[model samples]
Target: MPAASITIIFSPYHVGLRNHRVGDGPNRIRALGLIPQLEALGVTVHIDEIPPVDDFEGEIGRSFEVLRRTSLAVSKARDGNSFPFILSGNCMASVGAACGLGIKDLNFIYFDAHDDMDTPSTNENGYFDAMGLSMLAGKSWHWHTEQIPGYAPMNYKDRFLYVGLRDVNETQRKTVAEAGADVIWGDAGKAVDFPGELEKRLDKRDMSPSLVHLDLDVLDKSVGMVNGFESEGGLQEEDVMRCMSLLPKKATPVSFTMCSFNPNLGDGDKIAGIGIRAAVAFVEALIATSVVSVQQ
Candidate 1:
C-alpha cells in the first residue's frame, strides 16, 4: 500500500428532510477549516462540491438528483484509489456512495441513532431521510434508485451492521430483525465494546470491501447535537473512534460518509469541531491501515 489520499465530496443539499437548517451542514464543516486539518495529516486532499439543482420538485425528486451527482463524484474518487469521504446533510447519500464504489459484494456499516429502514408505506413522518437504508437495500423508492447514473440496488438484507440504534420505531426494528441485519444496541449511559463486536462479525463473514456511513446524530447529546434528531442513548466519541480504528483492518474501507450534521441548530462551531475530530480519527485509522498493509 502506498500513501493514502482522500477525496472530499461536499453535498450541501437537504432534500431528504423537510427541515430548513439541515442543508447547511456541508458548508459549515468546510468553514470550520476541516481541509487544512486533513492536509496536516500528510495526505493529498481534493475537495469537490456538488452544485445545487433548482429544477427538481418535491423532496424525493430533489434527493434523487443530488444523490445522482454524489454517485458520480464518489465513483471518480474510487477509480483513482483515493478514499471518498462524503460530507452531506442527510444519510441517503450513503446510497450514492454505494453506487460509486461499484462493488457488488460490499458490506455496509451504518452508525446512526435511527434505523433509517422505513419504507414508504411504513413511514408516518413522510421524511425521505428516514427511508435511506430501505432504498439502499432496494426495499423502497425503486424509481429514484433507477435514475441514479451508476446505482444498482443491493440486496443488503444480511450485509448491514447497525450501531447506535436507539431511536428506531417498531416497524423499523422488525424490519431489521426480519432482514437478519446485525446490530449493537445503544444504551443510555453504558459503553459497549463496539470495536470488539464489529471485529467478531467481520471475522465471521467473508472479507469484502466496506462503506462506513456515520450519521452525526448517533453521538450522544453530551457530545453536542449536530442535528435536530438528537437521541438520548447513543455512543460516545471514543466508541466511534474505536470502531473506525478497527474498520480498515477488519474490512477494506473503500468509501466513507459523515452525514446529518446540521450546524445551525446548536453551537455551530462546537458541533463542527466535534465532527472534525471524528473525521480526523477516521483518516488516522485509514493511514494506519495503509502502513500495516505495506509491511505485510
Candidate 2:
C-alpha cells in the first residue's frame, strides 16, 4: 500500500443532490458502499464530505472551502511525481478536482448522459450546479466557475473529451459542437474503439494529461439509474468497461469519479454498483498491465 497510487475520494455532499428513487435508497448514502469496494483497489481514498448545499450560490461558496482543503492535502502529500490521481466526487466536485489536479495540465473525459453545458444565462432552471461542465470548459457558468480565481481559462483543445451524450439541451449540444470537442455519441460512437480508440482520444489531446469523470445516470433507466437524468442509447457496463480498459497510460494520471447515483432506485443501486464495480475491474486491468509491461 505504501507504494500503490492514491485514490482520493473527494465526496463533497453539500451540493449533494439526494438521488430520489422509487422503492430504493438515496444516492449519497448508497455511495457509502463504494468506499470499501474502492479500498480493495489498493489505492488510498480521501472521502471529503461537505454538508448538503442545495442551490447554485450555496454550492459555489462551500466548494471553494473544499477546494482549498483538497489542495492543501495534496500539496502536503509528496512531490506528486506519482501517477495522476483517481478522484470521485458529487457534482461540482469535479471542478475542485480540476483545480486541484493541476499537474502539467489535465484533459477531462466527462462521461454523462447530459451535455451539462448550459450556462446560467442559457439555463431554463437558472441553476449553477447544472452548468458545471460549461464552467469547467471555460464556457460560461453562474458564479461557481467565473468567480473562482487562479483556475479558469480552462484548457479546451489539449483537454476535454465527451462521451455518452443522449439528453442534451440545444445550448449544450451547440457548445459541444462549437468547442471542437471530440464526442462519442450513441452506441456507434461508444463502439468505435476497443482499447485503441480511447487511447488515441486521450493521447491525441495536445496536453495528454487527463482524468475521467463518470456521471452514473449515463446508463439507461432500464439499467436502473438512481439519480440524474438517464438517457437511452447509453453504454452498457461491458461496453463502458471495455472503453475504460483502452485508455492510454502514458497520457496522464487518471481517476474515475462517478456521480448522480441514487441508492433509492431499488434496482438502480444494483445497476449503479455494477457499473462502478466494472470500473474497478477496469482499473485492476490497468494495474495488471502496468505490472506485466514492467516485468517483461
Candidate 3:
C-alpha cells in the first residue's frame, strides 16, 4: 500500500474569547515538533498555516473570519486528495471543516467535555465557542454563517454523536435531547465499550463520510488540561486512543479537527507533549485503518 499522506492546517486565532491565549495553541504545538514526530512514523506530511484574521469588529466577527479562512484551506487540501488534519484554537473551526468537505450528508462525532450546544438565547456567558455544535447543527447563528462562502448548516441532528460530555448545563442538555442527538457520557474508567457502542450507532445511520472533532478538554485533567475549561472524570489517554482507532472502521473519516488547547493555562510543555502524542496516535490509527480497508 502507498504511504499515508496528510496535510496539517494550523489555525492560530482563538476568537472565541477576548484577550485569551488559546490562540497560541497551534504555535505551541508546532514549536513542540509535531511535524517531525509524524514524519518519523513514515507518513508524508504537509503543513499549511492559516493566517490570523485581524477583524476590528469583535470576537464574533473575528471567529467567523478565521473559520472562513480555515474552510478555504481545508477545501484546497481535500481537492488535492490529502487528508486534512486541522489543529485549531477553537472548536468552532468544525464549521469550516464541514464546509470544506462539501458533503451535504455527513456524520459528525464530537469528542468534548462540554456539549457546546448553546445558542445565543440560551448562552448566559455569551461565549461563541460554547455554541459551536449548535451552529453546526443549524440550531442558531444563521445570519453570520450565511456570510461565509460555501458554508451550509447541517440540519441532520440525528447524525451527530456527542462523546465524553460531562460539563453540560440543564439548558444544553435539554437542547441536545430535543435535537435527538446521541450522547456518551464521560467515564473515568474502562466501563464503557466506546468503540463497540460507536460502531453500533453508526450502523444504524446511513453510511456517509464522517468527521471527528476532538476537543483536548475531553481528556481528564490528570492527563493534562489543554484548556481553561477542564472537567473531571474524563477519558484517559488509552481510552481516547482506542476510540479513535475504531472510528474509521465505523465510517469514512473525510477530515478531523483537534481544538481548544490553551498552552498558557497549564504546564505548557506537559500539555503540548500530551497533545502531540494524542495527535500522532490518531494519525497512525487512521493510516492503519486505511491500509486494512484497502487490503479488504
Best by TM-score: 1
TM-score for candidate 3: 0.89
- Better candidate by lDDT, 1 or 3: 1
TM-score of each: 0.92, 0.75, 0.89
Cα lDDT tens digits for candidate 1, 1-296: 54347889988778843334777887888888899898887778888888767778777778888889999999887677678999988788988988888888888888888888899899988778898878877888898798887777786656888888888778878988987778888877777677777788888885457788999888887878678788777877787878777777777777889988778765678877777888887787778777322112
Model 2, TM vs. native: 0.75
User: By lDDT, who's the top model here?
Assistant: 1
Task: Give a tens-digit lDDT track for model 3, residues 1-296.
Answer: 32246889888778744325777887788899999998777777888887656644778788888777778888888777678889888888888888878888878888888888888889988768998777777778888887666777776467778878878788878887887778887765546655566677777875457788988888877777578788776777777777777777667778889888888876777777777887777777777776322112
| lDDT measured at residue 13 in model 1 versus the true structure, 0 to 100 | 74
Could you tell me the lDDT of residue 194 within candidate 1? 71
Please give me the total number of clashing residue pairs in predicted model 2: 12
Model 3 local distance difference test score = 0.77
Error of 1 at 176 (Å): 0.7
Q: What is the C-alpha RMSD of each candidate to the true structure, in Å?
A: 2.8, 4.9, 3.2
Give me the overall lDDT of model 1: 0.80
Model 3: how far residue 226 lies from native, Å: 2.4
